[model samples]
Target: MIRLVCSIVAIVLCVWKVFNWAWWKPRRLERYFRKQGIRGPPYRLIHGNVAENGAASLEAKAKPMNGFTHSIVPRVLPFLHQTVQKYGNLSIFWVGGNPRVDIMNPDLVRDVLLNKFGYFTKMKPNPVVKLFVTGLVSYNGGKWSKHRKIINPAFHHEKLKLMMPAFYTSCGELISRWNKLALEGSFELDIAPELQSLTEDVISRTLFGRNYQVGRQIFELQTEQQDLLFQSSQFAYIPGQETTATLLLWTIVLLSMHQEWQEHAREEVLRAFEKNQPDFDGLSHLKLMSMILYEVLRLYPPFPLLTRFTSKKAKLGEITFPQGVQVGLPILLIHHDRDLWGEDVGEFNPTRFSGGISKATKNKVSYFPFGWGPQICIGLQFALIEVKIALTMILQRFYFKLSPTYVHAPHAVLTLQPQHGAPIVFCKR
Candidate 1:
């Protein structure tokens, strides 16, 4: 009899644990949000919105958009886009059982990112995802502060000036390859892989002080790890490599599509350097190129969504978020918002940044391509310098136009990337 009783007790406990974890807890959170007047998609049991999210993603990916367009909302983020349209910007949503509040308001995004209080902390990515990459971007509090301090010197203006030779060398290699490919006047080539290699080479050399041949193993591992993360439904960052590569690809694509802007940027590059190798000072003087890069970054930010968790109960603007609620700052949505960026939000006009970032956007937080405030990208200066040098060198050697076979599909895995690789016809200048 006692044995039977013990078996019954074990079964009851297992059932209760499963119920609490899968149903009870999620329902309680749903009730809390509802009570607070926050609306979201009606939560389904166990999986919540995960199944729906996956389905929507599959559908979006299957259908690629036509032509060169900056509006990636429908293709890359259909679920969130639909949610905001139906429920509103500040609505709550589910990622599995976890209740996540989507904050579209720039004020709340600023508050969350700035993170003055210790209450808001980064959402710990899944352990498998964490294994892929972890840097200062993954840290919090004192650890983050320490890492930032140590890394700051590497990206300083003086340090970047020293690294210009490394940039020039890596870009020179790319130029040589492109020249060979374009020997018969013009030739079609997929620039995405080339740019990826170039950026990886730049990072290997500049950051680790190793040549591409020596650092090739590290880059390959990182690429493999990113591919693994991309296959997983759980969102996680692969850090610098993909983001930098994606940015370069988009910048090239945008420039190719807008021939006038491409010519203008090339002119700026030539005028700045005057047939000399691009130095940090001369590259900085290329205002037109700077404007073009800024505009490209605005349209396609590396990390589309930035997530934080409430450690303790906290108030953001008017709403009070309970402890453990995930808060998502949709960076892509903010960057492309027509109200914030005017009617030309979807259009690529580098002149928008002619007066610089501060004068370009309606609000300070609206234009956070590299993120904002204390947690702004540490490698910002380094990345920009590399881009400037590569672009300067390319403009000097060749001009490129979109190949007829090129498909314009921008999607986000860890970062925004062309769904079909960026194929361009490169011609000797």
Candidate 2:
């Protein structure tokens, strides 16, 4: 009789747990956030807003934007854009059974990223994702700090200076290929794969200390890793190759569209190098190029969304975040926010960053292309130098414009990527 009673109690507990997870806990979180004036779309049972997100995204991606516009929050993250529009910055929305409160306000974003008290934590990555995206990104506690310490040396300024020759060689190879392709003065080519190859070679040389071409037997394994990294949409961070490649590709496309900025950047690059090979110190003189790159980063940020989850109940300013709820820092939305960036927010105006990021952001925690605070991407410095090398070399040798066949479909699969390839016509300088 006692065994029967215990078995019945166990069954009852299992049923209650399932019920709580599916229905009760979500509703409780919704009510909690709502009581504090954070309101979003009403949660609907188990699939809460997942279906809605999918349907909205499908509708948004059905066609390209009406024209060339950088206000891509509407295209890349249509569902979140709509939620923010209707529900305001601290809006609470549901992701399946999980409740996510998106922090669009810069102040809240700062607190979450700083994560001073360990209240907020990275959403544990899907196991498959952790295979390659391990190390600093995968860990949160002491392990994260330990890995960060270990990896810090690789991107130190001295290390990057040593890699300058590698940078020039990879870029020179690109110039040679484009020289052959544009023999007739102009060549229409999809520069995406070409740029990817350049960044890939740079990464190979940096990480493995040799050109990938020299050892096909080993580098073939690297190719397989590349395929896996891109194939997952739940990717928290884009690898070095994709991140830098996308930056260069978008810079080319944006510069092509806004030729005046292109002229300014080239003039600056020419003055910096002036027929001499680009060197480490010479990069500092390319101020206009820096402004253009920053502006491009603002417009087409590689990581569109910065997502985190609360590990425990915590207070931010006057508001409290409950445990089990996710916190989203929408970089795409915040970068393009009218309040933060002003009326001409959608336009490609590199001049906005003429006074550098501090002046452009007015010392706010608003501009973080590689994220901010402790967990910011470690490879940012390396990525910047790599991009500068490619841009400087390209500007010295060729002029490029968007190919007529190029489509302006910027969507986020893993990172924000061109749905169709970035086809640009390059003319010999």
Candidate 3:
């Protein structure tokens, strides 16, 4: 009789816990948001909007955009695009029963990212996803502070200047390989993998002071891990996941499409370091190159979405978000917004950045290619320096044009990448 009574109590306890977790909590959060006048797709129990989001993404990916265009909203984030159009700027959505508010307003995005009151914190990535990539980007509180401090010195301008030799050496090898491919006038080659190798070599040698062999092995492992993580969770965005490679490929493709700009940049590069290899000092003075890179980043930011969770009750603008609600700052959508960037938002015009980031965008917070506020990328200078050196070297050796077989399909695996590899015909200058 005692055993029977104990079993009944145990079953009751399990039922109560499940009811609270699966139904009660979600409905309560929905009510809270609804009271604030926020609207979204009605929440379904358990799965939330996962099935909807996944299905929309698959359909979008199946239909590739026809040509060179920055209208990636439909292709990259179809569900969010549709949701925003239906529900408005500050709409709530679900990620497996968790209420996530999509904060598209730049002012609100600034407030969440700045997090001056320390109420917002990074959404903890899944443990399996964390294994694939985690560093300063994943940490929070004291650990994040400590990691940033330790990593800061390595990216200092003076410290990066010392790494110029490594950059030159790696870029030189890449140029040599391209020269061999271009021996018979011009030859078509996929530059995506080559740029990946170049960046990997640069990171390995400069950051760890290791040789390319060691760096190559490290990058190979990282790529495999990233592939596994992408396969498991389609929504996850791992920082530093092939970011440099994707950026380089896009820059090359953009330049190919705009030969006039490419020529102008090459002229600037030549004038900057006439008959000499680019050094840190000389690379910094390539204003045209800098402009081109900024424009490319504006159109194709690596991490399309940046997510933060309310660690405690926090007020962003007019809304007071309850603890545990996720706030998503859709950086890509913001970058490509016509209202923010004018009608030419979709065009590749490097002149937009000729006056630098501050003068280019309507708002400073709106143009966060690397990111904004305190948690901005520590490796910004490192990545920029590497790219400048590589571009300078390539422009000196060859003039490249997009291969006819090249398809302009940009999609996000982790970072924005060409769905079909960037194939360009390289002719020795």
Per-candidate Cα lDDT values, in order, are 0.80, 0.83, 0.81
lDDT of 3 by residue, 1-429 (tens): 999999999999999888877789889988998898888888878878888988998998898686777788888888888988898888888887789999778888888888899989998879886666576667789977866776677678888888888888888888888778777988888888888777767766764466667855654455554753332221112344267777788899999999999999999988988758988788778888999999999888887888898999999888989888899888888888888889998898889998888888755578887778998887777778878888888888889999999988777776888888999989888
256: Cα error in model 3, Å? 1.2
TM-score of 1: 0.92
lDDT ranking, best first: 2, 3, 1
Point out the worst 10-residue segment of candidate 3 by lDDT. 229-238
Model 2 lDDT tens row, 293-391: 999999999889888887898999889987777888989999999999999999999889989899999988898888899888888888888899899
Off by over 4 Å in 2: 1-11, 213-238
TM-score for candidate 3, residues paired by index:
0.92
Candidate 1 vs 2: which has more lDDT: 2
Task: Give per-residue CA lDDT, model 1, range 1-429, as digits (tens).
Answer: 999999999999999989997889889888888887788888888888888888898899898686677788878888988998898778877887889999888888889888888778877778885776576766778867766776677667788788877888888889888778877898888888888788878776875577766765554455555643232211112466667787888988988999999999888877777678887777778888888999889888888888888999998887888898899888888888887889999999889998888888755688787778888877777778778888888888888899999988888876888888889988898
C-alpha RMSD in Å of predicted model 3 compared with the true structure: 4.4
Candidate 3: misplaced stretches above 4 Å?
A: 216-241
TM-score for each model: 0.92, 0.92, 0.92
2 or 3: which has the higher lDDT? 2
lDDT of 3: 0.81
Residue 133 alpha-carbon offset, candidate 2, angstroms: 2.7
